[model samples]
Target: MSEKVIAIILAGGKSSRMGQDKAMLRVDGAHLLLRVYQVAVACADNVYVVTPWQERYEDLLPVGCQFIREARYEGDDVKQVETHGPLIGFAQALAEVNVDPEWVLLLACDLPNLEVEVLQGWIEGLENSRAEAIAVLAKHEKGWEPLCGFYRKSCLLGLNKYISEGGRSFQQWLDQNTVDILPDCSTDMFFNCNTPEDLRRRLL
Candidate 1:
């Protein structure tokens, strides 16, 4: 039996460092978000983009990609909705997923170098993943690369527990769970275009 897979792409970041919406950045004639979405579509059974502003990208994405409106933190102030980080955004999106996919591929919109073949290879190995593991992710010196990785759909229970208890850091939540290390791949594949200089380097 093949594992059913669904992909969730995170585009809810403020992009403070990039000085603009990273999803809308153009590379090789396609928006970065569209590029990542295309890769996800090729590798997974379904693809969903999670963000607060769905209308912003509805025109950019193709017909198959679905959108989940990320919730904003409401406060007493009528004009102030706190910007929760990616972990919360991911948790919310995962909770809203209608299908029971065995694995969920989580990606950031700014990863312009993502390749379908490499991701497919990774997906192929998920069936062999340790039963104790809640996620399969690449580990670098900094820590597990949570944004670009595979998480078990069943992990949402623990994820919600952590979030309800006020945990907001991906690294923190992942640290408390069992995770399998992804086989070594090219480091460039994980590169994030978060800054203007990073975008320039990506183009070059």
Candidate 2:
């Protein structure tokens, strides 16, 4: 089967530690989510932004950019929509993608340093990946960098099974699968704005 690529940018976080919406934060005169979406557009055939607030970002993106409403679960009798973190959010979006032999470029919305050329280079290597490999991701000292990487479309079944079994941690789920480590990547490329301090560091 021929390979097809698509991107999914997760933006449903509450930004509790950042004290503001990181996706809407401005960097170099561009919103964080818009910047990431542009980068994804450069390297992938299609780009999708997964967030709870679609109207907030709809005007920011250009034409052809799609939005996938982040899944929320009802909490208590009040039926408040509650986020279950990136893992669940990712699974919900992945289920909507209907491509065969697909390679999904998954990213967090706060990664402002992402470079289109670097991501394009990574996409070029997907064809060389092993048959058993389910994902191709950069590895840090702690573990695989799950957010900024690529996963096979075939992995949806395994991912859903893991989530149904109460597995939420990306690192935990990755450790149980065979993943190809991304080569020749700089740690700075994965730098994300999670807190005010991180935002300051990015600007400097």
Candidate 3:
């Protein structure tokens, strides 16, 4: 693909719902993050994992995959740094890796079945849509799938603006933007493991 694209795998969630780090959860004998990383490398020229605990996951990624450290409030005798939410991590990572790419493929690590075919198909769909949408997000009967989608560099300003205005909900932020919704709502690849039960039912 001549159109420059960067893939970003979000792995900085607190995983409080899972009671464990969902990114490290094994699926078919490999970490969920690693599986997502593999698919990303196949779809883009560059790939990055956005997280706060870079050291914890450095060895899990392939040789060339880079890390975009999530911006955290430095702590000493003061405030400390940690994962806040997907939007905050996304904004920080986008600033670091979005080097004038036509599109940015954003992914979440908990998606275990993300194949290269699925990813490439979305990129192709976005290209054919012929719309100047800032984002091309997945949609089903439920709602917009914001995490597993392609975003244009032009979206940076809007994302930052949303955060600046005290917006924390990604879904809420997306509702205000002009986004093309992809109708290939197959749960086979888009399903995410938010809890242990979800992990077993969807990924195991």
Candidate 4:
């Protein structure tokens, strides 16, 4: 059998830009986190939510969705090294899974248009390209979007090392890996909700 694909939802951000937890934001009738969780469930064998506060995510996450807390900013060597950022979250997740998955589809909770079909397309694209991973490529003006991408769990060690060195930029870590970009066409699947206007146009 092939290695199973896992889905990791990054929900630990301070949500400073949105003024509230983006995962708590509603699009259609479901919370954004739950929506993304549903999509992840559709595409992978397992799903996990990466957050610092399990209580904050209680209402936003569905029953049975596993939660992995990033290592706190202040703690022992293990803790300090694990709280850098998204990489920290991924590291904690890998510890829980105990095996290298074929891929771990990482997604942000702020995008309202991340649906099952789109994610399925991403998985297929990754397989077809024979690339190490597949990420949605934002336009020139938009820059690169890695929040919505697929990664191999075997890379967790290198990612953890980057975090230990105080690297917080996800794009920078991705640069050292084989990443294939899935260009955004007419529709922007990664149109994240950052401002009131963006939320209004996409969520409300």
Going through the candidates in the order shown, the clash numbers are 0, 0, 0, 0
Ranking by TM-score: 1, 2, 3, 4
Residue 168 miss distance in model 2 (angstroms): 0.4
Q: Model 4, which residues run further than 4 Å from truth?
A: 1-4, 74-83, 129-142, 183-186
lDDT of 2 at 181: 90
**Model 2: number of backbone collisions:** 0
TM-score to true structure, per model: 0.94, 0.93, 0.90, 0.81
- Write the number of the candidate with greater TM-score, choosing between 2 and 4: 2
Q: What is the lDDT of residue 144 in candidate 1?
A: 87
Each prediction's RMSD to truth: 1.9, 2.3, 2.4, 4.3
Candidate 3 worst ten-residue window by lDDT: 74-83
What is candidate 2's lDDT per residue for 1-204, written digit by digit as tens?
A: 335689999998888899888999999999998899989888888888988778888788887678888756666864355778999989999998775547999999999899887788888888999989999999978788899999998899999999999999999999999999998866588998999999998898
> What are the per-residue Cα lDDT tens digits for candidate 1 across 37-93?
999999898889999889889999987569999978778994455778899889989
Q: Which residue ranges in model 2 land beyond 4 Å of their true spot?
A: 1-3, 74-81
**TM-score, cand. 2 vs. native:** 0.93
Give model 3's TM-score versus the native structure: 0.90
lDDT of 3: 0.82
